[model samples]
Target: MTIPAATASFHGIWPALLTPLKPDLGIDLHRFGLHARALVHAKGCGGVVPFGTTGEGPSFSVDERRDAVDALVGEGVPASQILVSTSCAALPDTLALTRHALAIGAHGCLMMPPFFLKGVSDQGVIDCYRQVIDGAADDRLRLYLYHIPQVSGVGLSRKVVETLKRLYPQTIVGIKDSSGDTAHTLALADAFNETLMVTAGHEPDLPELARRGSTGAVSGLANFMPHVVQRLAGRPDAPNTPHDVSRVRLLLAMLGPYALTPALKGIMAALSGEPGWLRVRAPLVALTTDQMHTLQHALKPIALDVDVD
Candidate 1:
């Protein structure tokens, strides 16, 4: 079978969307749909990535993730614009979610290597992905290798990427480098920019990557600040590059002191004036009162408007 070239339509800012929850910590499908629609139709984001790291992907089970994707589509968020993060610690779960995303006609899937074991060989990583591609057995599969070593403990090496691309070129279409290392990201772009869609998950790196033909991001900051991320990814030389870069850095700095996902949720609570946004699954608690107050004060300087309805 002839492998087509990487997709051109995957370019632009796709927010790693925040998963809103109810007071009981159930997935709030109503608010979730609203946010997805707002990000694409109103905020000018290229699309939204749900159940990603920022969205607490692993915290939710396979069924919850599938149902939310269905609700998002039912509520008018086009499946073609959504990049579903179908990674799971177990191979069976990963295969199930990947098949579901393909069945729904999502633009693609963002999958990390099997993360339960650390320091696995490159061949082990390759074998893991091969199982998924072969098990999915779907010609429509368009996958982005998700590289976030700090979080996943297993990273995709250059050689591993090359081997997989060689074997499954059609299914392996792109890479999302959340390595948080500027040089590594640029290196991936340098090496694979011709044959793959290389996108940054680190917001500050957007300008530099954009200069090298990477015009997309799966950004956590875009959850509340989509326009800013979109502008940064547009062009490295855009006059507002410095300002946008600084703004993202400042906001990200606020997340440094707290658990990242909760800190982001706290900000969302403030932005939307809905305290329910503070709810997180177990093992991840909501921000404290003082923390919320501090976050609100920190955000006051940026004057961010609430774009999600």
Candidate 2:
């Protein structure tokens, strides 16, 4: 299947970056920019996604998010290589962030449906997205619909995706399936991989999705194991597929026992040797000392190389 010209540039491994915070829980822009640049330059990621689920998007206010994006761009990570997560509980906030991303020349914006409410009708979901597109009113906008039903309490349905694509083909360029269900991820690839860039958030599904012509991921695992994910998504024929898959599964298993954001931060702390990575914003606490110790022990056996400085 041929990828649409509009979505062609959105392929490859784009790590959903782990935002580092100061001890006061404010965003550490210096650390954040350095990490994003490292992922793209040193780790060979296609790009970096800021304020994603792994980065604790909803935890920060609109101002905080905007400042961080500006700082990242100011620090010399090309704006065109950054995909900003503009999802917010409110339509206005989402619009503001989306516009800001476009203003900065970001590669695209990744947005989820209005997740504050549950069991919303498909039309309602469609309308919410419609308003965002119409509200932003930017021809430069390239949007990737986010689908993570487990965390957001809402999921983007096929009908919703179809309707949005029909209404805004140029703007609605792709879908990020973080569903974690292999069947659903594959089905999405089967249905829309030709027209839209269908990306799996789950690392294990990357090889199969790549087989189906889906060429990229907005991956949490890519934060730490980018080369592994790059190989999985872009080099399925590489001899290391089995070993990479096993390593990803093992790392994900370590995250299973704790709050994912904090646990990933814990791993980042161990890798970078910066305890500042362990700090999380309010409503998400840092991993306990015991949890961190256990994570260290589990990761010691894996012996992942520290690629990011």
Candidate 3:
């Protein structure tokens, strides 16, 4: 029995939150809660999404993922403020992940098509979602299709979006297009105006989308600069400030090549005046000593108080 809850309004800055870890690489639920809270309080940030590619969702255990959700809910962050991206490579795992996220007070789920295989058809992708939504069995399990074919090798085509909405109009709520293509994102917005709140994954395109019915962004830029993103994404009437956007881009540039897990931890560690908050799992290596120095030098003028270890 699927419990269907009314879908809530979505469209604003959904930050891909950074997960803090202990030096030995254990989940620091306490710090995780603080980060969630921090973003919620930021100007224009609608809420936080904790398990996107930037959040290292693929690298975490099921328990770790659930615990992250638990921490946020326990901290009094409302479900409306969380859009949990329960993207996993396996159908069963994805279903389990969505179930957990919904159970832990997340209002919606962003699902990437299974990436373990290539050249999958829209039918297969639709079936994967059918299984996940079936397992969720609740009104709160609002599914937002995640489209980033460049990485996932599975793009959510127009047919897939239309078919899913037709099949489960209420259950399938929206989409986050990280395909990095303006044409595709624009097309989705034009096709499904009210039925699906299509959002851009890129920050620069927020205003353009807002004009075209795009409600907001699920942005990597918001991880470190939620306030800036919230300004452009959250405040629709505010005039575009090129200087403001450029400032953020400049600061983000100092973080180095944009493989974010380490740079984010490093920033958190620096700000908190603590050690180990910056430590991350292996296979996602940390900055080298010289690299760290370069980042420090590059980021020096940004005026944050991050310290060296």
Report the error of model 3 at residue 48, Å.
Answer: 1.3
Query: Which residue pairs show collisions in model 3?
Result: 3-138, 3-139, 4-139, 5-139
Candidate with the larger lDDT of 2 and 3: 2
Candidate-wise lDDT, in order: 0.88, 0.89, 0.74
Task: Give the per-residue lDDT digits (tens) of candidate 2, residues 1-309.
Answer: 798887777778899989998877899999899888888877877888999888999999999999999988888789988999999999999999999998889999999998899989999999999999999998889999999999999998899999999999999999999989999989988999888999888998899888899878889878887887888899887788888888888878877889999998898888878888899987888998898889999997675645757
Ten-residue stretch with the least lDDT total in model 1: 1-10
lDDT of 3: 0.74
TM-score between candidate 3 and the true structure: 0.87
What is the per-residue lDDT of model 1 for residues 124-240, given as tens digits with 9 covering 90 to 100? 999999999999998989999999999999999999999999998788888999988999999998888878888888889988888888767889888888888888898679887
Candidate 2, residue 270: lDDT: 82
| RMSD of candidates 1 onward, in order | 2.2, 1.0, 4.2
With candidate 3 superimposed using the best TM-score fit, by how many Å does residue 252's alpha carbon deviate from the native? Answer: 5.4
How many backbone overlaps does candidate 2 show? 0
Per-candidate clashes come to: 0, 0, 4
Candidate 3's residue-wise lDDT over 162-218, tens digit each? 889898888888788888797888788778766778788766667667777665678
- Cα lDDT over the full model 1: 0.88
Q: Mind sharing the TM-score for model 1?
A: 0.96
Q: In candidate 1, residue 81 scores what lDDT?
A: 93
